[model samples]
Target: MDLTNFLKTGTYLKLKVGLSEENIYSCFKKKDLSKKYYYNKLDKNEGFSYFYGDGALEIMVIDSKIYSLQFDPARYPYILTLFNNIIISHKTSFELIIKYLDIADIKWSFYQRYCHSRELTIKTEENIFIGCVYDKGDYKLSKFQVFEDLYNGFF
Candidate 1:
């Protein structure tokens, strides 16, 4: 995946395991606070400025069943960490997109580059979680693909 372009246009969808909408919103607000603190550190190191400006994040309910909280790349990690520390604090599953495409019934391949490169087929109706660590002027979100039929595998 093109990490640069991906981060630029990608939006994150975070699933709150067992929290109410109001609780999730409150926690997210606190997470944004921490993001501002960490983001300043990131900025000093020449990383992307991570901040929750107006409309940077939003909450939506789809189909009267699914509730999601969306955020930009800058605030994504912070929100995840907030859920981890204050809420679950153990295991969390969130999805990331390299880029948004219009086609819904399509398949794509995700690739990673290191000393060698590797690729894998990304199946449709699957959400992915990535573990990322920032270092040496770059961030790496490890590849994890979860099939829609195997939702329990991630939770």
Candidate 2:
């Protein structure tokens, strides 16, 4: 009955650890106007950086199959917002993390000195972690991140 097992097994945009660039591109929009990507020989991977609404997606692939991805914070005027039926950027928020994670229920250790804490990492029921890091002086959230266990045997 562990929810992490079910949640961690899921994919983003139906794109899993072994999906190709063509397979991934097929599942989402093809708006090259906002599409920006590159290939890194050192990593031996291709990267695509695409905008979604005011947010963005950065996908990385090696030998043609994706192994990692990221979602930027939610934004307004949502356009090309569908990443998957389960996870999303626009729906992502600190409150959303608490609703789905409830790390506090597990007695999980986290830091939140106040409403303006600089950073926080909440371990999720999915065995993944989502965080928002802030700029120190102004305490402005500078980054939104999702950390997932990397696929084994896949670099």
Candidate 3:
């Protein structure tokens, strides 16, 4: 599915990354797709929401450039059935994830500092860390986050 590109570009169907907001809006509008924008107190923080199926891509845009990307597989119907696509889910062990990423030598934490819940983080792509959050300490994957700007509290 070229998920790596999707992760990088923050758009499905192979859209160009680092494009202007005007360009993106024009492109999707021409294709008859709906998009939403959100802005908060921080001008450094702006987001665009593009909904497909039950899931949506909440892409962070700064200075009209795509900065970070995340996928909501929880709302996608085919996610669980596609077990082989474990890259986006927490269907495997944390140890195995670290082993697969070849970063086992680095310490693995049972809990994330932000949430105080057990979490596992492993590199999925260049500078991209996929974190699986286990809220109840069941050691099972409850949700996932695509972390590009780790400083933004996404870890």
Models 1 onward score TM values of: 0.24, 0.51, 0.52
Ranking by TM-score: 3, 2, 1
Q: Residue by residue across 1-155, what tens digits does model 3's lDDT show? A: 22434433335443444555565565455244344455654553556544443443445556667555555444445353122354544455545555644532333333334344355554433434446667555455443334335453322
* Positional deviation of residue 150's Cα in model 1 after best superposition, in angstroms: 6.9
The number of residue pairs in model 1 that clash at the backbone is: 1
Candidate with top TM-score is: 3
RMSD of 2: 7.6
Q: Which stretches of candidate 1 lie over 4 Å from their true place?
A: 1-15, 28-52, 62-66, 74-150
C-alpha displacement of 41 in model 3, angstroms? 9.7
Where is the poorest 10-residue window by lDDT in model 2? 138-147
lDDT of 2 by residue, 43-132 (tens): 534554445445544555556666555544444344222223334343345565455445324222343321244566543333333456
List runs of model 3 lying over 4 Å from the truth.
1-17, 22-34, 41-45, 78-90, 99-116, 140-155
> For all candidates, what are the clash counts?
1, 0, 0
Q: Candidate 1 vs candidate 2: which has greater lDDT?
A: 2
Model 1, range 1-155, lDDT digits (tens) per residue? Answer: 12222122232333342234345344456565224222245444322122243433444322222243333334323332321232211122222332332223223333232123222223222333333344454444333322123343312
